[model samples]
Target: MAKNASKGASRIRVGVGGWTYEPWRNNFYPAGWPHARELEYAAGKLTAIEINGTYYSTQKPASFAKWRDDTPDDFVFSMKASRYSTNRRELATAGESIERFIGSGISELGKKLGPIVWQFMPTKRFEPEDFEAFLALLPHRVDGLALRHVVDVRHPSFKVPEFIALLRQYKTGVVYADTDEYPSFADITSDLVYARLMRSQADVDTGYGASSLDRWAQAAKTWAAGGEPADAPRVTSTPAPDTPRDVFIYFISGAKERAPAAALALLQRLL
Candidate 1:
């Protein structure tokens, strides 16, 4: 049971959050600069990046094209939907806004738009009426688009089984996060997985620490197994033995300096 499962399944892409800096670890980049070449050099080491910057502002098409030109063909990009669309619970009413966002990326990002993550704040409560209405509207929301949808609910109250079931019902990808803010790597319900491993406070800046790479690697292996399990277990000690699959892993580090280092550590362990 502990053997490798994703042997022949598919390869997963590993990446870090944005190319920006935070005060948490001195500074990610130099004193005053956001260089595309530098970002591309760093991104080349990974397969994808989670564009959190778009959460605060709209993405320009020219900028998107530049990013595409900077990165390799295998590289993928995942963008978080704006706060107005997600945190405001405007899902039922953000149709036109969502369309604009998608339109801006269609030509630039093209096939590289991995997922549009709707990261909800912890304060928000899951009102079934509002939630169901939102879910019901998803299919029609992306009617003509080619991108997949992903949700990352940070509130502990949103971890119920039914919430996840709803994700699978719509063929949406659940953000498999490793965080203390909520449960650690909650059971996922879909085959097309979108995940991020945030550093837990209990972990060291380096080594295996508390990043949950082991769990993810194991899960990826298990998922690589041909037959789906009757149900996902509370925890996995060993993932099933199967071929490898095309897995995508993103590391959104709370500790700045350790972001790339931690990502490399997991990559070494995984590949």
Candidate 2:
């Protein structure tokens, strides 16, 4: 499971997109769980959480501190980069927005901060030079805390060797989306692995069936051990260095109501 790996050892964290969901009140949350304590409850069950609200709006420093304090010491939060930084026509010109978002109290998360996902629109195409310029804008550190960046490029144009090369050059990861709706690839480009699984089915009690969850658990272990899953699709034939790396897997999209159950189920398998 590697969930309690020693210092300097790789860890595998499984979680859902976010903690707040209306449907979760009836299914995942307790009968009288207060809404204000949802983050605390979710953090106890899940190892990590992807903060989706940051994608739509800016948050105050106090909010980040409160979130940090509400969770367990081992809990992590992967924030979605602002839409203004990734949804624009010219990504190269998003330096100001990127700076604004990063400087907007995210450092308050401190050691609990995980990857920052810069999710591009589905219609956004890959432009080599412009994309490189945008990647250059991502700072390696924020307030002395190391920052990890991952790109969630949905367009098929990103399925190329050049795109992978750029990511590898910047040491930024490409989100390994486990879904048919986007360009899914497993080329490892950084020291950490970030995955967003979106194929959850509503009819399934655990979002994904038992076999699928088992496979994902195995895949996560393989990634943490610095190995690629043989079944995963890749755009580049070149292999990444086989070195231990931290892995973050989040059950996102699809049957959103079942995401918490899916995360918990996966965590159980990891154990």
Candidate 3:
């Protein structure tokens, strides 16, 4: 098990990946602008969402305000850090760039900024010097704000235990992605678990269409209740279940035009 498993809550915070295509436009409103209404609909069922599109394009202040107005008070958003901050660019010399990006994002989103997701591409192999310099460039505190940092290392070679340790040192959450392009959930290790369960398997798609939704809701309950296999394994020296910890589960199979339907399927399961 990873570090801080004891401190984190077990009750999974469920949600789908970010929205890309518009589904409500046909019936709800004209195509575009205020996506908050869509967010509100999604949040009514799921507790959280990972904002992937934000990295592709920055949102205006008015847009963030509208987003805040749309979603409920308890709902949380997990935003991706800008590509310029984590992509092919070298971080040591990019200190000014990183600072600028964070400053802009914070300024625009305010309270809705959520966790800063630094998702590196698989092509960008792990270089200790670059990574250390990169990590150092990140702002410890952004304008009196303590931003939550979550790292998604897509490179396979970057899965070294030392890399995980670095994440621990920064107190950054590591993304537990179930993807063939990068490392799998079992290979990746981190204290703060950010699981992205993409529905790549055929069973997942079919399952979503069937009774899997019910199963997820039930699973959510089970996870919330401190996980099953109640008794600690007699052989191993793993820590016993002491208290529940918060788990974030994001379903991502909705990249298509049928996103709303996918979102709805996930919402049904989450609800």
Instruction: Provide the lDDT at 199 for model 3.
Output: 49
Off by over 4 Å in 3: 1-11, 23-36, 105-112, 185-191, 200-245, 253-271
Give the per-residue lDDT of model 3 (tens digit) for 106-167. 54445545667788877888787788777777776776766767777777777676676566
Best by lDDT: 2
List model 1 lDDT by residue over 143-196, tens digit each.
344756777777766656667666656767677776666544334444556667
lDDT of each: 0.62, 0.92, 0.58
Which ten-residue region of model 1 has the weakest summed lDDT? 1-10
Q: What's the best-to-worst order under lDDT?
A: 2, 1, 3
Best by TM-score: 2
**Residue lDDT tens for model 2, 26-117:** 68999889999999999988899999999999999999999999998888999999999999999999999999999999999989999999
**What C-alpha lDDT does candidate 2 achieve relative to the native structure?**
0.92
Clashing pairs in 2: none
